[model samples]
Target: MSQVFDYIVVGGGSGGCVIAGRLSEDPNLTVCALEAGGRGDGTLVNTPTGAVAMMPTRINNWAFDTAPQAGLGGRTGYQPRGKTLGGSSAINAMVYIRGHRSDYDGWAALGNEGWAWDDVLPYFRLSEHNERFDDAWHGRDGPLWVSDLRTGNPFHARYREAALQAGLPLTDDFNGAQQEGIGIYQVTQKHGERWSAARAYLLPHLGRRDNLTVETHAQVLRIVFDGTRAVGVEVKQHGEVRTLRVRREVVLAAGALQTPQLLMLSGIGPARELERLGIHARLDLPGVGRNLQDHPDFIFGYRARSTDTMGVSLRGGLRMLLELARFRRERRGMLTSNFAEGGGFLKTRPELDAPDIQLHFVVALVDDHARRFHLGHGLSCHVCLLRPRSRGSVTLRSANPLDAPRIDPAFFADARDLEDMVAGFKLTRRLMQAPALARWITRDMFTAHVNTDDQIRDVLRQRTDTVYHPVGTCRMGHDALAVVDPQLRVRGVQGLRIVDASVMPTLIGGNTNAPTIMIAEKAVDLIRGVSRVAAQPHNDAQAEPHVEPHANYAPQARTVEARHAIA
Candidate 1:
């Protein structure tokens, strides 16, 4: 007999971990979490500074690459997502950001009810246990621990000083009232180790409960449907095929890229596209894989004349050994830092409602313009458009679940996207030229002294890539195209929900790991009926949008555009 669970959560990533942890709290409910990756038991994965190398390696990363994007100088972008228990959060830079409040309110305005800044702030607060700010903006008692960077490099200080000199105010808290300014980033670290979602949400409750079954290295192929209702999930575990029955719901917590691909593989996508691939259409969801969004980033690298470059000193044979010795003895020094530490949000043009660009300053000299660079004394700064005007999609390569999806970020697809990136590059250059950093920095490492806007635009096109924040594939909206309602339940499928970054109606303007975890927390309430669905606020009142089995399916049309206009 196939084993049954009250809920089956796929992809034990950041959101999956949170959702499984919270849902299993009820003793009556049995939750099974299926993770495609191995056990989260690697030393490098837990170390704060160790993520940089481990991220690119196959140990903890998926290391997926995109199809050649014509807009990006015809280059194939490297897309690195986590293939571990904690998902990308396990391998991410661990930066903690909630993005602009307006970013959330914009979703509510887009018909994602109960998702405004006011409604979601409590969930963000509920999931966070910030070490620094214990106020209205931040939470003190939560599962995730967010702390300020303890070790600030000289370059970080210089970066902030230069930003202030360039007229950008030095705000202490980017998560505070105003986000327009430069400041040190707050990381999701504790005791100088990465406190990933697995560590915070899953590990503690692993042995405590028998009702919660976590199957690692279990790659789910597709959701098993009885007519239009998702009743179970089929997974391949250690070369053995297994079907886990779900008594209540099947939650797809796979990240943006994989969620839609899984849906399409199950024949729940555009009828035409699925038919072309010989897939029988379960439901014609045109937007299943549409509305893909990502943050396009441009890097500015320069060589330092002085010995102040931390990358050079750390990469040195003797210095690295010394740092490792110190790190092993006591968790401190360069080994304790994530290196890409200092950066913040700022308005490129004044009179804007929100910051237009986000910056990330690193202590390493990265060239190739790729990750393959001599760790000599060099500095790199990355600037990305906070809200991109462009969009893309994820299509299935085949019906096989083992095959990776075709990811088309279509970076710089829109001319407006190119313009935003170019403006961001110019702003970053101005910050680098400020006296504080200019006194220490000398030659341009990557661009090598380019002064023209077109030259900068070229540099933007050549070096730009995703910071790995992808969302909106299974978008939540009040329109026909919406895959899921505001409560995260699938529109055309019963007992199926998506609780990850994929369900975000609009991409948040900052790091997405934190918000992903918050979504899972909010999702728990919805599943338990602690909170009502968007349109159906009354008890026993079902939202008409909730699709049942054997129903005539017709997706609603939606306008794919951010309500918060980028001025």
Candidate 2:
């Protein structure tokens, strides 16, 4: 007989870990988590600086490449996803941002009930154990550890000085009452180590909870359905095929790219596409793989005169060795750096309800997602349009379950996105040119001598790509195009739910990790049929309304012309 679990959580990523961890807490419920990748608890995964090593190698990342983007001058973009127990959170920069409150309200406005800023704020607090903050805006007793960067990089201060000089305020917390400002980021680290979702939720509970069973390297091939109800999952592990029966539900937490692909492979997608792939259509859900969204990012690389920022050199190599020694001995120093150490949210236009552009200050030259290497040392900053209008899709390549999905982010497909990218590029350039940083920059390595509207547009078309945040492939809403309902239950299917970034009706304005975890935290309640109204009392002041523009910070008139010209 096949092993039966009350809840079968597929893909042991951020959301999967949370679901399995929380559901098994009931003691009466038996939960099984299936991970396609390894345990992901190695030094390379736990060290903050180890992201550089993993980003380039296929060590713990899917590192999938996208179909050539039509809007990006026919360039195939790189898409690196975490293929480990914690999923992308195990391999990401570990920046802990919950996005703007308006981002959630926007989802609610789009017909997703119980997803408003007020309803979701408590969930964000539920999973966070912030080390530096203890207030109504933050929680101090959650499982996930959120702390300050242990690396005492002097350049972080310099970046803040540059931001202030460029007219951005220094905010103490991006997840606090106000999010529009420049500041040092709080990372998902615990005592100078990367605290991935696996570490935060899964690892500690392993073996202790008899009801929870985690199986690593178990690749789910397809969802086995009985009529319209999902009953089991076919999995391949160690060259052996097996089936695991689910008594209650099968949660899909395979992320935006793979979740949709899995749904299509399981015969639940556009009927025409399924027939073309030679698969019998189980459900003709046109929206199963549509509505792809990601932040289109552009990087500004500057050759630096100082070695404070990470670079390639003999002296830098020696510093790295010493830093490794420091890390191994005391668990602190440069090795704890998350690379994109300093950045914040900003509004290109003052009248906007929230920040439209988000910045990521990098201590190393990140060219083409680090695929292209530079010989010497430098610093780079990433500018991404937070609220992009362009939408794309994730489609199946073939019937083969192991085949990579066709990802078409279609970045800059909407012309307004191009205008925002140009504005973001200009804003980032201005911030980098501030006196504090200008003194160290030897030259602009990428965007130099580019000033005209056409020049800016050309640069944006060539250089812009993803900042690794992708969502909405399995969008949740009440509309016809929505694959999942607001409660996260897959429409037209029984005993199935999507509990990952894929269910986001609209992409959040900042990092997706915090929000993804929050989704899982809230999902357990939905699954348990608990009333959120009586859960806990929270301060409404935490979800403050958008601030009016200050007289001194009004957007320049030239920006209007630039937007029109680009359009």
Candidate 3:
């Protein structure tokens, strides 16, 4: 006899943790959360700087490599998703951004009702407990904690000065009245430690709640369907396959890459792909693993003259040791740095409706998602296209459940995205040349003497890759290709819901973590049949943004290059 639960949340990731935690709040509803990785309670997860060690290695990470992309000149991109309980939140840079307000409104425009900026703002507020702000825009009491960086580094001011010198506006808050400016990013941290989604929602409720059962190393092979209804899951835990029955729903929070893979593995994806793999098609949902979207990023690395920037050196090593001591004592120092210490939102051209590009100013030189390390102290600034017309997919490598899914983020498939990236690069390069930053830099690590649009395009194709935001595989919409409805229920199946980034119809305008948590927070209400109707925007929330005009960017932003296809 298999154990039963009212809800069986697959993948104890960012979304799964919230789903399980929220459902289990009712003593009557028994919820079980299954994670394929360990319990994510290690020092590596709690410490903010430990991500430097975790992201570059396979410790609690999936570390999957994509199929060779012709976009990056035939180079395979590295995707380091968190396999542990917190999911990517445990391994990510901990930058908490809710994208742009227009992002959610755009989703509503695409037939996803109740997802407009006004509709989702309540959920965003409901999930946050801000350390600084307590206004209409931010929540004062919530499960998740959002706080300013504890590292009082002098570079924060310098980064601000650099942006100002480059003629960008300033905003004290991104999740406030304005989001279109440069500012220090507020992180999902509390008291200098990383406050991942699981940490905020699940960890505290562990032994306190008898209705909640958190299972680690439990990998679900497939959803056990009773005809078209998902009634249970067949999971492999500790080398023993077990059937965990679900009384009400089988929710998948297995992230963008895996949730769709699980659907396909359960014979609910494209009929042609299932037939080729010899799996009987239970539900012919063609959009199960389609519509993959990500932020294709280009980095500008500069060797810094100052030793204060985080890097490997005798002087920096001595400083890090001191910072470690300070962290242990007061939880405030360079050890609390999230690497991407500074962030900005900008439009390549003044005519765009919203910011076309985003920036992540890393305190250290991060190469290949921090896989390859460089010597000496340096800083890196990442510029990525916020909304790429390019699309990709996540499909089955084989019929085997244990096999990794194929991820193909066909970057630059649309010629327009590359051109926008070129304009963004030039704008960022101008900031790098500003006196505030230029005085600290020795030389450029990449893109030196590369001026022309064609040269920029070639280098972009050679060097551009993801900034770790992947979404929209199991797209949520009313359209036929949409795997899930706006309510997040699987289209052709019953008792199955996807509550992760995969359900996003389109990638948001900024970091995805905060928005993903809001998705799960809203999903809980949907699951409980108590979902609120999206309210109108707050009185103060609807102000027009103050955008500085760039008369020169609009004309030269056009692409003169031909489209390139990946083989």
Candidate 4:
């Protein structure tokens, strides 16, 4: 029997949860959301400490690895995405950052209409129920809970003080009027418990509404297309295959890595690639799996002089035992910590339009997304290039949907990106060495010996990986290769839309979780025909050149040659 719904949301992730939950608000509509993973409300999914364990393993993570990158000496980089109802949000750092306002404006400038900061600001406010902030910039009543650090950990204050002592300015809010500065990061939590999109949006409506259906362990194979229109999806659940029909639209809320792979499997990708794989092309959308962008990140590790950091030791193990009791009683303790307690956006060059890099101060010594372990207590800091000229792709490993996509981030593909990272390394190293944090550091572990630009470049290439903010694969724009338009409608495919990070035309300055939820919130309005701004086909010549959405992309023209100016 074919299940039927007015709307079928594929991939019950951050975006799918919002899409299904909001559409269910209209009693007249029937919605079905299918997740590839288990229910994301388990103890491991809700506990912040569990994220540390999950990321290093496949507990609730896809734990995908990239194809060998020439930039990293032909080494494969780890890519850990959440494999649960909340998607990556369930196993993320829980940092509630919406990115810089200029990032959205940059999208609008590139011919994506109605996506400017001013237009998308309302959606950001609409999705957040902030616990501490209440102003023109924040919302007080919403599903997602955004709050200040509720734990008693004292490391965030020390990190911020170090950033300030290192000559960086302080900004209380990274999402406010000013986007430049260092401060304690706000998290997606409620009473110290992890508040993922599933908890905030979908879980509430699971049993409350018969109109909405959320199926777990249901892997979407491909879209069932009648000609060029997507009418349903063929899903495999419990070792059974079934076709679920959609009355109106089929929205792909899968993240950047999976969405394009699904589209390609459905015969809606580059015609040549599809033909070579023995699959008939339905739409020949050349940009389907192209334009992959992720933050190329490098972490600086150090041996801690104090016991404030999270590490393996007799004292730390004892503290953890006591924290388990404290957390069970009040949900507030060291167990509530979201390892990355402090972070900020900073500019490497004074001439750049916005911050070219971002900082994440961790309470533990993180190596390869915590895949690698170390002894004793230590701390680490991450410095990632915010905007890179490099662009990679997501292509099908095989015609089989069960197979993982071949992810090629092509980190530092553009030479300038490496240069900028070299510059960023110097700037970040100085901040870590500031006197405010010097007292806490016993010895530098990774980059202490790195001094020369060439040495920095060599070390970065050796250790650089992703900060897990991959976007722009199924890009939204008004170009020949665009997969979706500004309204998020798939090009050349009727009754199909992509409402996820895959549609991001460019990379945002900070964490992608908050912005992803906002994208889904705005997508709901667009789908209901209640969009505030009407979409238009833009071909403005005054705008920047249309950045290619493919494997071999031209470097951004704005990339400034790194001079030893600031250092």
Rank ordering of all candidates by TM-score, starting from the highest: 3, 2, 4, 1
For candidate 1, lDDT tens digit of each residue in 1-567?
338999999999999999999988888999999999976757888877777676666777888889898888889988888898899988888889989988988998888888888788888888888886766666778989887665645666677668656755665667766566676788888877788998889878987987888989899998899998999989999899988899999999999999999998888989999999999999998999889999998878877765445564534656768767877887666777776787878676666788888998877665532457564577788889888978989999888889989999889889898987777777777788889988877678777767787987787887888988999999998787899999898888899999999999888989899999988989999899886222212221232222122111112111111222222
Ranking by lDDT: 2, 3, 4, 1
TM match of model 1 to true structure: 0.91
Candidates 2 and 4, the one with greater TM-score: 2
In order, what is each prediction's RMSD in angstroms? Answer: 9.7, 4.7, 5.7, 7.4
Query: Per-residue CA lDDT of candidate 4, range 405-497, in tens?
Result: 999999999999999998889888888988888888988999878888889989999999999999999999988889999999999979999
The most accurate candidate by lDDT is 2
Candidate 3, 73-160: lDDT as tens digits: 8989878899999899999999989988889989999999889998999999889998877777888688899988988877888987
lDDT of each: 0.81, 0.88, 0.88, 0.87
C-alpha lDDT (0 to 100) for residue 285 of candidate 1? 89
lDDT of 3 at 8: 96
lDDT of 3: 0.88
Cα distance off (Å), candidate 2, residue 553: 22
Estimated TM-score for each candidate: 0.91, 0.94, 0.94, 0.94
TM-score of 3: 0.94
The alpha-carbon deviation from the true structure for residue 61 of candidate 4, after best TM-score superposition, in angstroms, is: 1.2
